[model samples]
Target: MSTAGIGLGLTGFGVFFSFLGIILFFDKGLLAIGNILFISGVIMTIGIKSSLQFFMKPSNFKGTISFGIGFFFVIIGWPVIGMAAEAYGSLILFSGFWPTLSVFVQKTPVIGWVFQQPFIRSFLGYRGKRAPV
Candidate 1:
């Protein structure tokens, strides 16, 4: 299999392990393992140079810093707080992909039906736009 495919599998496992860690009372070891796996998987998926460039982009500095600090905290045995910071950093870092994700969700077959529900649609739809006067 290709490196990207292997990386994707690793990423999936990393996410699974992270969730498992959360479920198991925020076990630091599991969380740390998950973080390592996730980071390595990302590097493998995108290659070293591109991953460095992506993280070093000026617009991504804040997320990168927060993520780095959170990783440090996790290493230092502060799993909960570190995960919180990491979550925020992830949100900031990945916010740009939400639109693409939404599109994908809408296009999928079974999952798309759930998101197409009226209530779900309303929740996902735009709000608070004013008409031209």
Candidate 2:
């Protein structure tokens, strides 16, 4: 109902699309769609935050850095390596939003727990409590 709600929705789609893109990296059409959705989620969720307070945290710093490097490789590096980087970067980025993202994923009747596993959270670089509202 609010902008934040929309942002969260975009983030969900972003995750889904990124996964799809990774799956169909060889298919230009689906891969393009995936790339678009992934970027849209990041922009909607964080682009509007002009305040330094929104991005100055250590986790956010790590996430953005990972995302930036991954994006660069995905755009112009070797195919196989690029895809891997994209996945890793996305994991970190998604982890950065774990608190909020989990709220949506947890609503699912099945498989939510899988997504919330400690190893996945740690791998994605999720640390400390959920991000500030």
Candidate 3:
């Protein structure tokens, strides 16, 4: 299976667990499982750009940062912020997927506006731009 395929599959698992987490909020174990899967799915979907084609160089940097923040928040038992952080982190990570997504979906919606920033551009791995020297 392709990376995109794997990423999407993980995304499904993540969503499932996230709903499970919500339903079983009082149960720490199930909640933890849900939280972990959601974060993992987002990160994997982001494709860890730096690792892609070692010679190509990654244009993004903050995916790991947001991901860490989310992970930490979850560890500290802050369910709300942790999930929010994870969500933002995943969106941060999704920059790379934007170009391909654009081809399929046409409008990028709100993220289309956020995509204007230089930082967000990097996060998207500089999709459509020439490689740096």
Candidate 4:
């Protein structure tokens, strides 16, 4: 599960970076390079999953919901994905955005400060909230 989380996170970051790069850069040559890199990153990520296992896997409610969301995102984000691929190869690995964004929000200033607030931190802590044995 942890490995899957890491893989998904890397994929999300790759895709996000790729999108930012292509949109920010106008050089055709550079864009071509970014696209190639993005494709490579995607291929690497996908390689982590076994094809037979993927098809043969069973789905629970969580899996079904996740798959639905993913399918919807892919359908809606197709154009954005192209631009992302043209910008940064890392964008190819974008499934980890939620956790990455969470960590980023905690570390980066402005938005970061919001997530890092004392009250929020205390509320999120589980150390003292467990039920007595």
Candidates in order: C-alpha RMSD to true structure: 4.3, 6.1, 8.4, 9.5
Q: What's the lDDT for all of these models?
A: 0.83, 0.59, 0.61, 0.46
Q: Which prediction has the highest lDDT against the true structure?
A: 1
**How many clashes in each candidate?**
0, 0, 0, 18
lDDT of 1 by residue, 59-80 (tens): 8889999988888898899999
- lDDT for 106 (candidate 1): 65
Model 2: per-residue lDDT, tens digit, 63-86? 666655655555664445655666
**Highest TM-score, which number?**
1
Worst 10 contiguous positions by lDDT, candidate 1 = 124-133
Prediction 2 global C-alpha lDDT: 0.59
Worst 10 residues of 4 by lDDT: 86-95
Ranking by TM-score: 1, 2, 3, 4
lDDT of 3 by residue, 17-120 (tens): 66777577634355567666654555566566633532133444465567567767766787677767777876776666656774333236666566556675
Over all chains combined, what TM-score does candidate 2 have?
Answer: 0.52
What's the true lDDT of residue 100 in model 1? 72
lDDT tens digits by residue: candidate 4, 56-83: 3553334433433433334354434444
**Candidate 2: residue pairs that collide:** none
Deviation from truth (RMSD, Å), model 4 = 9.5
Question: Could you tell which candidate, 2 or 3, scores higher by lDDT?
Answer: 3
